[model samples]
Structures are given as structure tokens and as C-alpha cells.
Target: ANRLLKALFLVKYVDTFKATPRNLTVLVYDRFGLDLTGLGKQVQEALNLLEAQSYVQRNGNVYEYLTNEEQEIEKEIKAVDVDSAEVSSKLFRYLSSDILKTNKLKYAKNGQDFSFGYKLDDVPQGNQRELTIHFITPETSYSDSEIAAQSMGRDELRVFLGRDKRLLADLRLLLKTERYTKQRTNSGATPSMQAILQSKQVLNADREKELIERLRQAVGKAQLIINAAEIPSSSQDAVTRVSDGFQELVSRTHTNLGLLGGKVYPEQQVAGAVQSETGLFDAATLSALNSPGTEMESWIITQTGLGEKVTIKKIVDRFETKPYGWDLGSIEVVLGWLVGNGKVALSVDSNPVVRTEVTDLIRNTGKHPHVVVAPQKAYDHAKVAAFKKFCTDFFDEGAVPSDPTELARFGKDKLAARRDELNALVSSSRYPFVSQLAGVVALLDEVVGKQVDWYLTDFNKADELLEAKEDLIDPIKSFLNGQQAKIFDETQALLNTNAGNLGYLPTGSADTVKALLADANAFRGNKMNQLKTAADTLRGQIDDIVTDKRAEVTAAIDDRRAEILGSTYYANATPAAQESAIRRIDSILARLGGETQAALILQTGATFEQDDYPELLSRLVEAQQGGDDDAPPPKPMVSVKSISVPDASGVLESQADVDTYLAKYRAALVATLNDGKRITL
Candidate 1:
């Protein structure tokens, strides 16, 4: 009895292996035999046994196969009784009793017997399954029973079974007999029933063709609904709109059908058909439409060469009028594509548009952005290299950069650095050249320091601007190169010329000139002309100082000569003494005319007031009267001998007594010598 129940459960399990819900009536009649009325109790017992084993679930007369491991069930069902009417009757009674318990139960015609019907408790809910059934006969509508079954909320169809009952019964018997023979031959091991019952439903060529035709009709209906929406019906513009609408519909349909776990139908066939009718979906057409972007780039490059500005309005007008008469919208689209792909550049008011700004510029139409050929990768690389080289050659050597952005950054940094350098030079007091570099610094501020946006956006004109900048800066750089040395040389030369003219006045006479030279040597500016002017002014000052010093020295010498000649000592001196004094003064005057006379006179004048002119006069008079040592003394005219006068007491009592005695003696002597006698004391 256990073996018989197991075999019945195995047959039911195989029939519903696909998870298709089925009731006990169909499960048993379809696989086993409908003539087993007497075995209804046995079938009921077998079902109860299978349910106890957890292999299937019974909801009224409906059964759902639950076990996934069919091998375990095969192992359990070792053998079965081929002629067990008692077991079959038990199963039949169990199914019939459950069906009779349901309140809304009904019956269906099955040849001469009635098939029990019941609701499938385990049927899926929510989304319903869609099925397309093909009938062999040309029936236009469903029968009453079919409609009634469908109304019960089950996707059920009624069909006639054409095979004879005997053949069905024999087929069941043959399966059972085969199972029994396999169990016996293999030592009571049942063969796998799934291998015999599991069959695949394959659609033959005719059915496949019919399914394709049905899909075509459905897609046609979708396209018809899209067409009826009043969209344009000709031209590429119309085709583009239709294609967009078709794609949207296809996407929505796929999403809706995908909810039921249905495979998405490929819509490419219908889409391709629509595209083919208008010749808009081919590769050639897409290439042709995009081809203008390349041409536009070429045109921009050509226009740039001709020094003509290429604006969006100009581009549109050119294409709209030529053999390629594209509309404004189409031209805008192509231009946008060109800019987006980096094939060309767009700018408004001399400023390039960023990626996020491109759309607004293209759509606004009134913006009239200028277009230029986008810098190629190779060209950009070369530009960066050239910019770096220029910076190294003319500015700083460490200013190499790798890309356009870095190139711009490095350029600005270098320019700023140079500006700062020049500013420092201009602000420094040590350098005398500050005032001469005003124009150069102003130029740098205008072209580089203040125009930051130019460096950031004007990549196409980088080389040109750099060249212009170089030209403007060349003179400043040249002037600054050896400027300090030049100023120092000029200052030194001025000092030397003035110092030579001063004629050795004093140790510190050239101090001011030395200071000016020091300033020139230490100068760090680019104002060449200002420094030169300062040098000239210093030279003139030195000339004035030297002239004053020379005149002062000469006047002091002349005053000293005048003082010597007007002195009473010189006046009372003998002729020879006076003559000698005159000669000595003349010699001093002659020495004053010497190259170092100013310094010598300064030294001489310091002792000029302390000169012993009276002593000098005495020596000059003695030498003049003494004559030569070998010469004889001149004879006196009177030839008088020595005469002496004494005081009254033969001693000098008082000056008055001495004077009286000398007078008496002098009178006596005079009287005595009245005949021309000469007196000597």
C-alpha cells in the first residue's frame, strides 16, 4: 500500500513540476486513468500519505507540488503494485470528498463522465499571465464552458480530447508496467519518472511565424498611435521626432511588460523599418550630418588665418546660404557638437566659454559667440613648450609648465615676479634710475599684471601676446642689465675730473663725490637717464666747490704778500733788505702757482701770522752792509779816533747826570773837531 501511494504521488509530482497549479481530478485522470472509480478511496489515502511526507500541499481538491529534491522521493518509492485497485479507490475518494466540501464547486463535461472543478488556492495573484492560444479549428469565439471557466478568475480553456479512452488507459498501464519491470530488474529501485514525463514545448516553424506576425501587428498599432499625435510627416526633422517618439513608446512598453516577468521583445526591427523608410538611421546619414563640424573647424582655421573674426551668426549665415543650406537650428546643433567635442572653440566678448557655459551660449542665439579652431593636442603641447622656453630665455628659468592651465599659471607667476622686481627697483632710494622706468612698469601692469583674464582664456593668442610682451620689455631689461655699473662709472669719472681740478686742497675735499660714486655702485634700478642726470649735477657741484677752494687759496696768498710788503719792519729796512724781502715774497707767490699750491698754502697760511719778519729784516740788512769777507773796510771822511765821555764822579750816577756829562763832552769835542772831525760811538 505504501509503494502504491508513493507511485501515485510521484506521478502527480511529475505533472506539476513546473509549478503549474492543478486540482486532484486533472492530476489523477490525466496521468493515471479516469476509469479508476473504484480506486477513489485508495487515491485519497495515497494523497494523504504524500501530504504527510511534506511532498505536496492539498487545498481542498487542489494540490501543489512542494518538494524540490525529486531524487529523495524516487529513493523512497522503491516499488509499486501495478494492479492495486484498492489504493486507487482510496485516492479517488479523498479527492472527491475535498471537492464536495467547497461551497462554489462546479463540474465540467469530460466525454461521458463529469470532471470535478474547484478553485486553485495557490494560484498567483496581482499581475495576470498573458497567453495566446492557437486553435486547430476556425472558431471565431469561445464556448459557454470556456467563458464560464475564464469567469472563475482562472485562465482556463476547454478543449476536446481526441484520443480514445482505451488507448489512454493502455498508455497508463504501459507506464505502470514499465515502472514495475524497471523496479524488479533493478532490485526494487524505481526508475526516474521525471525523465519520462518531463517534456519541452517547442514551437515549430509555423507557430514561430505566426507569433512573429502577431508581434508585428502589435508594433504597428503602437506606431499608428504615435503617428496620430499630429507630428510632422516629412523631412529629416520629422523623422527625428518620430524616431524619438517611437523609442519612448518602446521603452514604456518594455517597462510595463517586464513587470509580469515576460521577456522583452526586440523593437529594433520595427525601429529599423521606420528609419529605413526615411534613410535617417544609416551610418552614412549620421556621418554626413556630423561632417559639417569638421568643415566648420577648417573654415574657422582659414578665417583665423585671414584675420577675420568668425562669429556664430556668420557661421549660420554662411551655411544657410551656400550649397549646404542648413537651417539655423541645425547649424546651431552642429556648432554645439563641434564645441562640445573640442573641435572648435567658442567665446563671447573675447572670453572663452567653459563647458557648463557652452549650452547657454549656443541656445541664446543673441550672444553671437566667436568661434576659433580648438588647439590640437600636439599644438597645445608645442605651445606650452614654446612658452616655457620663452620664460626661461627672457624671464625665469624655472618656469616650465606641463599643460595649458599650468602654462597660463606659470606665465602669470613669472610676469608677477618681474613686476615685483621692477617695483622694488623703482621704490628703492639707493638707485637713481627709478624715475626713468615709469613707462616700462606701466606697460607691464597693463599687459600682464592687470590683464589676468587674458592669460587665463586666450590660449590661441598666447604666442602672439608673449612676443609682444618681449618686445616691450627688451629695452628695460637691457637698461637694467649693467645699469649699476654704468652709473658707477659715470659717477667715478665725474669725481675724478673734479678732484683733479681741485688741485689737492685737503684730504676730505672729494668726500661728496665719493659718496655719490658709492650710491651709484650700490644702485639697483633701471632709470639710466635719471642716474646720469644726477651724475652730471654732482659733477657740476664738484666743479663749483673746486673753484671756490682755488679762489680762496689764491686770495689768502695775495693777502699774505700785501701784509709783508706794508709792514713797518720792511719799510725801515735798508734798500738791500727791502729788495731781499721783495724777492722772498715773489718766490712765495711763484710757489703758490704750483699744482699742490692750495694744500701748500693751507699749510703755509697756518704759520703765516707767526713769521719773525723783524728778525729776518735785521739779517738781510747786516748781510747787505758787511759785503764780501775778502773786501777792505771803507775809510771814514773825518778819520776821528775813539772819544769817551764819563760821569762827573767817574761813575754813571743817574741817567740825567750821564746825559749832562755826555753833552759837555760832545760840545768840547765838537769845538775841538770843528775842522770836520767824524764822531763814532
Candidate 2:
């Protein structure tokens, strides 16, 4: 529209694009060959009005056409905006990619060496070494000045996780399972697919979920190796151990995927490999792809919910004659069209069957237990909500067929079959309330599409006759239940009046009141509670069964739930997944109290299973020794992490903390090739 308008406006002067540059202004009268002199202020007034609208803007002596970005916001609000229901629904389906999550990494980033910050008693046995704790700091480049230990100048001013802590984490490691969700783009599937692929491209390989998961697993078993080292021979050794910790982690990670002959077989390759949460969460936050589930469901779930399996028919005949209400013919036509499109499926069975026969299913670890794919990340909250609303309101369920031949055929073929019974019911005083049902439908149409301008501007008899089938059916169900309740009450009253009905017992005895035949089977003393307890116990056994069977449960559980959990897949299962989760729990618990580790854990819940407890000694560590207690410790370690980018496909230590990573990455990428170094990019 903008392009067409611009082209039409340009044709007024009949000049070349080169002559009429974008910023140049042209008088409307000269281009259209219309005179403004006779019109006086009227012509100029209208042009000025157009200028205020921002479709065109005024320059020194001319009008400049505005780009789309420069256009003024639309002032006219439509009645039925539906506020993004269509887009939001899509986001919910693919929530994992769009959803954001944060996880804690263990241990604070302490540098290679530092002055002992506190008394000898302050050091915990966790990272052991008694300290003389003299601090030496670099006051200037090339000068390692021995100042008073714990000097408070330039070096001391820095604080690792202050308010300005870096949020630039490796996204792949940050959000696994979590996805950035956005509404489906209005442009259709091609662009959407392209965007998804682009997202995949942008994801850094090292930060993938599978890689991080492997590191987490390896770290779980490998950290115990560090426990074996009795002392740090040098400060650098401590740093080296932390760096090596990452590799030790990678080498040792155990996966739910089976290892054949102590190695992963090609067939055992899994899509379930643990990736880095650090990278993923950050990326998810930035991109707003967190709502993977919503995106998938808006388009896909409709097939299941509105398919041929669901059949709609009027229960009563009288309702058909009501103005604009659905008749038996209308229902048949809608159902037939739906079936033709494969939108509905007919099934005698209550549940649908799934087919899942395959090999090489994805499972680097067993089904990740913690999270679902995000529907939409919080980043695009407003947009996703708006799109979802649009889908619900604007999507036409295809146009209704109105040919005379088809209508007559539907009346004969479908309605005639049920005519006798429907007629009899209609004649009866208790004919079902279909008119009441139709009104509810109209209300819902307005509600779901309140923002849609068409709904507000128009009204029709068909709208009044539409029915919210689910809502109408609910009251019918409730009324039937009420009748059933009355039947029970009447039976009870009759039982209470007769002694012979009470098994020939004494009239006043409690036993006489307990009618064996009339009472509900569940009324036995304490049996309700006893049965509930049994049900709970059975449920627990099911959970336990899953835990126990995790070992041979090497196959990934990526299949739809209805397909798995059958007799076949669990033919010989073991506790492999449960054990893995338990091991992770233990590993996380072990790293408790380390500042950096705690920070990561607090955000992520627990990356690894931890098992340590706090002691009273922890209280003593923070105790002040003198007055004006702002005094600093003799020496303290500052946690550090590093990543060095080289010209070649360089290596990175996965375990390095932010500082070390920043230091190395900056040094490698700081200068340009023109400055004597090849650019890291």
C-alpha cells in the first residue's frame, strides 16, 4: 500500500526517480495539474492535514515521503483485535525454545592466588589449605609491588558479582529444554521455517544442550577426583584443577543412551544429549523463542481436537426451526466437510491409537525430567498473546457449503434416520433446550474476537443461533446427574420406612438402616479411605517402577506418552535414569556454600544433586576480630574463568568462569588485523 501510494504520488510530477529524490518536496497542484489559486486556503489546509498524518512530512521547502518506520501509529482501534490469541496459542505449543531458565554453576571464580582474607580457622575443609595468607598485588604494569597485605586501591575496588555482574552468558549452556517462543509470523510457513533454521544456525555449537549435559554428567563423577588431591602444591595447580575439572567432567559424563562395549555405538546416538543451560537460557532470553510449545500446538493441536472423531448432532427436533439455529442438515454438512478434509476422524474406540516402531531413538540422557519446551519466552509476552488471540478469532473453519442439492441430500440421508425418535422427543413436554444453547454460542464468538472489527460492526441471525457446544452440554450433564441423585434419595427414603426392607432386623438398630442391596458399594466402614490409600500406594509403586527400570531404559522416551509406557518398551527396564538423576543430585549437594556455585544453583534450582550440610563453623568464619569491623581479611581467593580465541579453531576450557573467559577472549579479539593480529571472528 505504501509503495503504491508513493508511486501514484510520484506520477503527479511525471519525473524520473533520480530527479525526485526521497527528501525532495513537490507541490501537489503542479504534479496533478490542479490549480490551488482558485481553491485558496482549502487546498493548503488539506495538504497540511496530510502532513500532520505523517504519511508525508514537511522539509524546508518540500515534503518528504516517510518510511514505514516513520509512519504515525494507527489511531483507529478495531472492535475485534482478539489481542493476539492466534499468535499466543502458537507460542504456547513450542514454549521450551522460547522459555527462559537460569542455572547455577558450582564454586566461586577465585583467581590463581590471593591474600588470605581471614584467620586460619576461616578456611573450610571443602577446598583445603592452611594459609599464611600474605597478599601481593600488581600496582602497575610490570611492577609486582609488595604493598601492605589487603591494600584497598585499584585491585581491591573490583568486586566479582556486584550489581553490574555480566549477564552475557553462553546461551547454549543457559537454556536447554527452554526455548524462545514467538507467535507464528503473519507471512506464512516459509518465512517461519527460515527463521527457525536461522535460530538453529545462530546457536553456538559448544553451548548445545547435549554438550552441557555431558559436562554436567562428567562433572558429577569427576569432581570426586578432586577430593583425592590432598593439597595444592602451588596456587596455579588449584587453577589448573578447576580448568581440568571441565575436561574431567566431559570425559566422565554418563548418558542414558546405552554404551556398547564401553563406548557409544552409532545406533545409540541420541538427540537427548545434555546441552549447556548457560548458553541456551541467555539466547532464549534475547530471541524470544521460548514459547515452542504454543507455536507447535496452535497449528497442530487443532487437528486432534476438531477432527472427524468428534461428531455434533442436534438432540431435539424443535430446535431446528428456531431462527438461525443449526438444523440436522447443517450439522451433517459441517461434519461431512470436516471429514472430507481429514479434519475429523471417526473412531469407534474412545482413544486414538499411536504407532511408534523404530530404532536409534534420541536419548543422551533419559527423558529430561525437569522442564517442558517453552510455549513462548517471557521476552515476547505481548506479541505471543496477540497472535494466539488472532488464531482463535480469525481462522475460518473453511466456508460452509450451501448448495441446494447437498442440503436436500443431508436432510434425507442423515435427518430422516433419526426423525422418528427426534419427533417424539420434540412432541414431549421435556424436549431438550437447544434455543437456550444457541444464545451462549453467540456470546462466546464476541468474547474470543472482541477486538475483531467485523464482529463489533455486524450482527446476524446465524450468530444468535450458534451454540457453544461444550458449554451447552455441561448443563445437560449436570441435570442428568441431579436426576440420578434424586433417584438415590427416593430409594433411601423408602428403605428407611420399612423394617422388612432392612433384612428383617430390629427397626431401631443401626444394622437395620444399612440396606445391603440399596446402599452404594463404596459405603462400607473406612473402606473409602482404605481404597484411597491403596490407590496412592499403587501410584507410588508406579513411580518406583520407573525409578527401578531406568537401567535398561536406555531408549529415549521422546515418543508421545500414549505410545511408550506399554508392555513392549518396558519389557526389561532398570533404574538407569533415576540413578543418573540421583547421582547428579549428590554432585550438586557436594558443592554447597561455594559462592559462584551457589549463585548458579540458586538460579537453576540444582544443576547437580548436592549432599553437603552447613555447620556452626560457617558462623565462626564471618565473625569479626576487632572494632570498626569493616577491616578486610588477610587474603582471599577471587574466582576466575578464561576463554582464549585463536586464529585457528581454538580450544576452550568448558569450566572456566566469567572473568578468566573475558580476560582471554578480550586479549585474543581486542585488536584488528590491521594492528598486527588476525581478527578472531
Candidate 3:
């Protein structure tokens, strides 16, 4: 026990640290060169004695030397004969428990040998269990290189060589196993050890050059996988060697290995340097690992084929798992590319999403969005081209759009603008013929404005509808060109004719024009014919009015002439008197003929009145017959004294009585004047 304790303290002193259980065990074997056969019981006895005396404290499998009597212990260890067979066997047993406790291996003592196997629960199945046995012989050396080399030959070796060369070798073995497991799982066929090691030997690199060369080969393999998956060239840096001599492969490609999945593990530790397995770059395992964009497209197509209504959340969930494990940002970028290219259709709350809006929609979790394959019709090149041509021809300011989203924008922004323009044109006061279009304006509103508006939320449907409704352009053009233009010309012609003939249209004819302008259907279909007939009728009415006015004026002139010629005043007159009266009547008739139809009618009544032209003609005749042209006519005096007062106050009690009184007064005054007699009021 003193010898073993001195060895423990010596190891700590030599290594300048506390001795771990494995360290103590390794030191005993190196120093004494002991036969490790049948040593477990003797090693337990030494530990039990040292622990009872408090010379050492046991922490897990490590014996920590605790004695203050270091000098005495060292002196006793120096005096003892550690080379004796019995003492050697006891020294062997003294620290064998350390190695035994450090592992889950079951040991059995033979005559001159110890056999180690896995504990029952830890044992591999069938023949693998037989390969797990570790034999420590008299010639065995407990060194890292030896243990690492030994562990490589056994497939079922499960020992953990903690912080030792064997740990690195085991880690390499673990990487190999992971690669093999992934290959077997993917291809369902076991890869030979020779094949796995042919690229680079396993647990064989002892120098920096070999390790660096291995790292380069690993990177090359990872690049092949990345290339096969069609990952962007920028992602080639996913596996790269840093300045620190460690190769780190980023785990962007999520794949499952038995022990290395979704984690950063040290693949091999050499010369204080570590190689980390940050990703799975095995091509066979990553055979299903496609580029994010391509994988997402395939997923959507497959889901659609399965009759599944795939949501954005569902896609995020799918890609965020094994095999295609992608970050949310990566998923969004790929999804946007697919949608922008018209490969897939995206919608939020049943409203279609355009390419530019996909990123925001994906980021906003509150919006539940669905994805599916875009309809072929929405992107049909022939249909899209035809529709673009239609838009270019129909709209005055139209521009050809490239995709469904741009087309939707055109319909909303451009087509809507055009519709408003048409509406303004029809409703404008400058184009009074717009009233002749009947349902043309309404039709434009429906097709150009409201129909496009209805599909604004759905870019694909909007694109499809715009393509299918190209026929509406021609009819709208025809209405503006044929019916509206023709009616304007015809109506203006009629108004000009009326202005030339009668100076102004009559009140009834003006009202007819107003009604035609007011009725929206007045010039629609057969109504257009009716408008022409109404215009013709208006023209005819003006002509008739002019004719009747002229005839009336003619009659007035004839009657005045007859009055002067047939009267005794003109018959007994001199020829000069007759000529003078005839000249005066002809001058009045000529003045009436030059006036407008309305003015002529007004002047006809006045010109033929006895107090007007006829009175003037009579006076002219009298003057020509030797009568005084300026003689004052006899005046009859109106005297109130000669009239008797009718009780006007009594009769003027009401408005009717007052009116009757006024009528009598007027009659009496007129009668007095006619009789050439004096009358009293």
C-alpha cells in the first residue's frame, strides 16, 4: 500500500498535477512492469487499507493522496522491495481497481491473465460480444498509442479513453462508425472498412501534414455533397479549415448520425488540435438533401399532389426538421424565389400574395398563408403575350407587364386609371354626345374597373381574367368612334341649320333637344335612328315657322295695301296720293321680311294695327288729298260737373266692387271721347 501511495504521489509530482485514476494505473504498469493477471482482488485490498488509514481519499475512480506523513511514506516505499513477485502482484491489484472502476467492463482473473468484456447490459449482440473482450497480459503496456491501436481492431470496443491518445483514436472510430451508419441507413448496404479507409486511413495520422491532408480530403468530400445538393457556391465555405489547424464544417445540412447528429463534436484530437464534425457531408446520407429552393418547390408540388392544402407554417415546420433542416431565413428566401418565378402560388387568408410581398408575409406569423402550384394558364406565354398586346392597343397609356404580379399592378394602377379617364370623358360637359352611349359607360365600369378590382387580391386570377376579356376593347372603341362621334356631328349640324333659318330654335324644339341630351338611351341602337328623325323633324319645324311668319307678314302688307287702295280716300285721290300710300306700305312689309321668324311674327301684329303702319298710311293719304298734314284735331272737354256721381264708396266695399267701378269709369271716359261730347265723372 505504501509503495502504491508513493507511486501515486510520485506521478502527481512528475506530472505537476493531481493523479487521476487512469494516470495512477498507467504509472504503476510503466514503473513496475507488472504482470496484470489476477490483480483485481489484491488492488482492492490496498485501496481499502489506504482509505481506512486516511492516507488517501477516493474521488470516483481516482485515489487522491491525503497523507501529511509524506516523508515517512516515501522512506518506507524506498526500503521495500517492489520487484518481488508477491509485492508486484499486490502493487498491480492496488491500482487495478482504478482502471476497472473507470469503465463498464467485466473482468475475470485467470491463472496469469485478466480477461475484460462488456457488462451484460452494455454487451453488443451475438458475435460482436466476443470481439469486445480486452486481454491484459504480462507483456501488455498501458500506453495511449498501444490502447488506441488495440481498440481499432475490435469493432465493439466501448472504452472511453478520457483525455488520452485512445480518446482521439476512439473519436475517429466514432466518426467512421457514423459515416458507415449513415451510408448503411441511406443505401441499405454496408460499406466495407477498406472503402471507408481508402480515402484516408483511420486513427493513423500522427503528424500535422497527415491531419491537414485528411482535413482537405474531408472538405473535398463535403464540397461534392454540397455540389450534388446544388447548394450555392457561396456555401462552399460551409466546410473550411481555419487558422487554428482545426477543420469546422457548418451544420447547415441537417442529418442524423447515431452520435453526431445536430451537434458539434471533436472528430479527432491530435497534438493539442481538434477537428470538429459540425456537419454531415456524406453524399449517400445527403442524397435526399436538395438545394433549399429546389427542395421547397418539390415539397409544395408533392403536397399539392397529395391533395394537401400546405400552409406557410407547415412548410416552415417541414424544412426545419431532419434531412432538410433549414433556418427560417433560408426558407423564406427560397420560397420567395419560387413564388417570384411563378413556380408557386402563395396566398394569405385566401388572397394571393405577390413575389415582393412574400418575405413580409413569411415574417408575419399572424398571417396564415397557403402555398400551391401556380396555375399553368396564369403563366402561359402565348396568353400573356396576347393579353399584353390587347392592353397596348386598347388603353391610351398602357404598358406591357412581365409577370402576374406586374399584370395585377397594371390592372389596378393602369387599367383603373384608364377606366376613370373613360368615365370622366363620358360625364364631361364637353362631350354631350356621351349621353348617347346608353350602357357603354356602365359596361366600361364593370369590365375595366369593378371586374379588375374584384381580382386585385388574386394576382393569378386577375392575370387570367384580363387575358380572357380582351374582346371588350373593340366594342368600347367602336362606341367612341362610331356612335358617339356620329351623333355629335349630326346634332351640331341640326343646331347650325336651325340657327341659320329661324335664328333660334323654338321653345318646343329646344325642349326636344334637351330631352335627347338627358336620356342616356336616346341614341342607343334603334334610338339612334329616332334621334336622327327628331333632328330632321326639328329642322322641318323651323322651316315651317319661317314660312308661316313670312306669309303672315305678306298678308299684313297686302291688307294695308288693300285698305289704302279700296278706301274712298285712296280711290278719289290723285295718282301721287295713291303712289305715296303704296310706297309707305311696301317699306313696312320689306322691314318685316328682313327680321327673324320670331321678330317678324311680333312685328306683323303691330305693323298691321290701325294705330301703326295703317294709321301712318291713312294720314299720308289724307295729306296727299289736300288735307292739313299738321292740323290739330277737335278736342272734347271732359267735365266732372256734367256727370252724376255713382256711389263709388258704397260700391268699392270689396275688390270685385272696386274693379267693377273702375271698369265703368273707363267705359264712360272712352264713350265721351268717341262721341266728341263732355262727360261728368
lDDT of each: 0.45, 0.28, 0.46
Off by over 4 Å in 3: 1-48, 52-292, 368-379, 392-401, 405-432, 442-681
Tens digit of per-residue lDDT, candidate 3, span 479-595: 467865587567766675456554545556655654765565443456556666777787678767776777876886687567657766567667876777677777777777766
lDDT preference between candidates 1 and 2, better one: 1
lDDT of 3: 0.46
lDDT (10s digit) by residue, model 1, range 15-103: 54432223343444545545665456656676567666746543323444444554244334323445534323322232224212221
Ranking by TM-score: 3, 1, 2
Model 3, TM vs. native: 0.35
Q: lDDT: which is higher, 1 or 3?
A: 3
What residue runs in model 2 are displaced by over 4 Å at the alpha carbon? 1-380, 383-431, 441-473, 481-681
lDDT, residue 501, model 3: 55
Highest lDDT among the candidates is held by which one?
A: 3
lDDT of 2 by residue, 1-681 (tens): 234245436653454442122222232334565454544454445445655565653322234444443342111111113323332232222221222111111212211111211111112212221112111111112221212222222111111111111111222212321232122233353764545434433432323443334323322222212212212222223223333432222222212111111221121211111111224223432122213212222433443345521122211122122221222332222222222222332222332111010011112113222112111111233433333333233222232222222222222232233333333433552323423433443344343322222222232322222233234434433433555334334434444443232232234433322333233332324433444443344334433433333321212111211222242322222345323433543444344323222224342232111111111111122332332466653221111112235543445556665556666556655533324322211
TM-score of each: 0.24, 0.12, 0.35
